[model samples]
Target chain A: MLIGACLFAAGLYMVLTKSNAIQVLIGIEFIINAGVINLVAFGKYDRYHNSGQIFALFAIVLAAAATAVALAIILNVYRRFKTIDPGKIDELKD
Target chain B: MEQGIFIFLGLTTVASAWFVAASQNLVRSVFMFFVTLFAVAGLYVFALADFVAVTQIVIYVGGVLVLMLFTFMLSSKETLEKLEESRHPVFTLKQFPALLVAAAFLIVLVNAIFKLKPDQLGWILQATNNTFRPQDNTVTNIGTNLMTTFLLPFEAISILLMMALIGAAHLARKERSFD
Candidate 1:
């Protein structure tokens, strides 16, 4: 549990401070992992139902899909702006 | 014995996560993310969620990490150069506030978890039941439950994954040059 806490904090810090889009995506992955750890840990007590493990499985699959789409979007952004830095790619802002 | 393994895995997860967040090179950070994910999977195994652990390895290690690596390597040379140039070797003022926020969040959450008895958390009823009637073979039970109770969600996930696949392909298609 403490491990999950540490990972969540570190991931959050990375997301907040990193200017690079890919780094932010990596940090998002970290946060998802922290949640996965917690879900599995809590599921330990409910061995009969395996709800936690099932949920973790669902989360993993979804996370994989999300990562693929985000990477694609990031790649598209790079193609257009010639940069992947979120700080630099602000054309959407007025 | 089990507790010792759990502690070791937990420590590994924390250390790798720290490296993932603090490393200077983006490549190294992604690699550290691999270690962090692997350690978290090990923790899942210790938590008696062996199937989830294996799924973590298959999906995270096999699928996501490889995709990240591909993206990293195949990104435009200019973008790569820019990434290398902006890499930070150590903490800077930009990160100080984020670190503070993370630390505060950790303290508040850990304190809350300690204060509230596990039983008091309404959703954690199964956790507090305490007898640990472990489903010795989780696969059969999980299969049965998915088929019976979670049938809808299980099917929905397949549709979601298909949509994601199509969407990503569409997003990444090569653009035509208008002459």
Candidate 2:
């Protein structure tokens, strides 16, 4: 759990500070991994149901799927804006 | 011996994760994140989640990392160079707030975890009384549970995966003009 907390913090820092969208995605992956660790750790006690393991499996799959979609969106954004910096892409706000 | 291995893996994971957070080069950071993932998988083994550990390797290291690398390669090299040049330093006025937030979150989570007591949990006591026999392998158990108790979720996940893949393919395809 301490490990997960540290990972989560690192990831949160990454997400908040990184300007590049892909790096932000990396941060998001870090956060998901932290959650998975906590889930698996707690699930160790549930010998009969194994609910934690099941939930972790689903979380991993969802993370992958979300990453794929996010990458695709980032790719399109790059094509249109010619830059991947989240701060630079402010046409939507303007 | 087991405790030593756990400590070793935990150190590896945390160290690499910090490296990932601090590395200047995007490619190097990606590689470091790879190390972090592998170490976490080892930690999962210590937690008796063997199946999840293997799945973490296959999905994260094999699938996700490979996809990230592929995307990096596909992007224009000049843009990547610009991104590297414009990268933020580890400690900066702009990043100070983010650092504070992350540190605060970590402290809170660690304090909560430290306060938690597994021995006081009723479910854990019941499980112990029921004689929780640790399985040598959990693959069979997971498979049975997926088929029986988790059938709906299992099926839903398959569909979700399929739809996500199709959507990704569609989204990534080259744009066409229709006049």
Candidate 3:
């Protein structure tokens, strides 16, 4: 749907444009949301199995778990760098 | 008509999402994320996914949004000035190419949507009708399918979520060093 597409674009722009680690994660959430919208819309047509709705549910849960893990990683990054900006923390080395 | 509510939800969802993408302050961005998600939940209800809509609110709005709020508060000293000071600019050298590509993608998708309306073998298929004609009990049907046909995936996802929780704990824990 156009709504989903618009969201995907906005999210992609954020992920690309923002140097903040948390902001990037927000963008990733947006991308997941767009997918969920499309899946649920398709589910409307599925009278028998509702596969789209099931997949959308799975996607939402998985997205939450992913955000938790990503936040943990970001916290660790902040610990090492004392900053949340992804651009400043280029190297893996502490 | 339902169109009125649908239009409102769509507008609010898109506008709040845009704010999330553009807001400068980290805290404001997180708050806007909550509004955007809540609007999306409303849209889910309109889509007739009652169970999914409820889960969206409970897990996404209630659970994830709270977690993000805590992260924002704990990571930074909260002040109104801090909110405005931490705002990042919308574009820089690293993001220019990305903006271009995403804009192009949006234009293409919109063009396709306009070109391929439902009757013209649309680019993507969608079902606008109520799926459960005989029975409107979506929750019951989903529960049955989860325990039966999709049992493996349902169980697997539970395991995956558990692992993710453990992994987050391990990663966030402080390191013990031998001095």
Candidate 4:
């Protein structure tokens, strides 16, 4: 649990500090990994319940699909601005 | 022996996670993220959650990370200059407060985890010992569960995947000119 919390903190740091779009996605991945760690940690003792395991499985699939969509959006951003930096592509403001 | 494996897994997970943060190269970061995912998956196996471990590897490592890599390849020309370009604005004194907030959150979390009861840990250990048997840790159980009790959620996931595919295609399609 100590390790899981530390991992989550590090991931949150990356997500907040990174300016590159891809790095942000990596940070999100780290956050998801932290969640996975916690789920597995909970699953460690609860065998018959299997709820944590089931939730982890669903989370993994959801993370994958979310990443796919995010990448597609990133590709679109690249096409429009020729840049992957989130700081640069601010044309969508109201 | 188990302690040693735990330490090794911990080191691998932390190192790859650091690389995911420290590497400037987007592709390298994505690859490191894959390694990080793999290490976490190993930890899941060590925790006796074989089904979760397999799903992590398949969905995260095999599917999502691959999509990220392909997007990186398709979206940019692999060049040093682009990679080196800084995307963040210059930070003023205002950003220090955000860092303070983050540090405070970390401290609180660490404190909470340390306060967990010894009895709780013992109960968790006993529960884990009873649930997982070596012989029954097969894909068949998961498959059966998904088909039977989890059928609705399973179908929903398929529909979600289909929507993602359509949305991605639409987002990446070439713009048409009416001239």
- Candidate with top TM-score is 2
Would you give me the overall lDDT of model 1? 0.83
Off by over 4 Å in 1: B119-135, B177-179
Name the DockQ score for candidate 4. Answer: 0.58
Best by lDDT: 2
TM-score of chain B of 2: 0.91
TM per candidate: 0.92, 0.94, 0.89, 0.85
Worst 10 residues of 1 chain A by lDDT: A44-53
- Residue pairs of candidate 4 with colliding backbone atoms: A45-B128
The full ranking of all candidates by TM-score, starting with the best, is 2, 1, 3, 4
Q: Which candidate number has the best DockQ? A: 1
Predicted candidate 2 versus true structure: per-residue lDDT over B1-179, tens digit per residue: 98999999998988888888877688999999899999999998888888999999999899999989988888999988987787666788988999999999999998987787655677767676433245555788788887899999989998999999999988888886411
How well is each residue in A1-94 modelled by candidate 1, as lDDT tens digits? 7777888888898898887888899889889988988888787766566777778888888999999999999988877777788988868723
Interface RMSDs of the predictions, in order, are 1.9, 1.8, 2.5, 2.6
Clashing pairs in 2: none
Question: For candidate 4 chain B, which ten residues in a row score worst on lDDT?
Answer: B86-95
In the range A41-86, model 4's lDDT, one tens digit per residue, is 7765555556676667777777777787888888877777777778
| DockQ metric for all predictions | 0.70, 0.65, 0.64, 0.58
Candidate 1 lDDT tens digits, B31-58: 8888888888888877777788888888
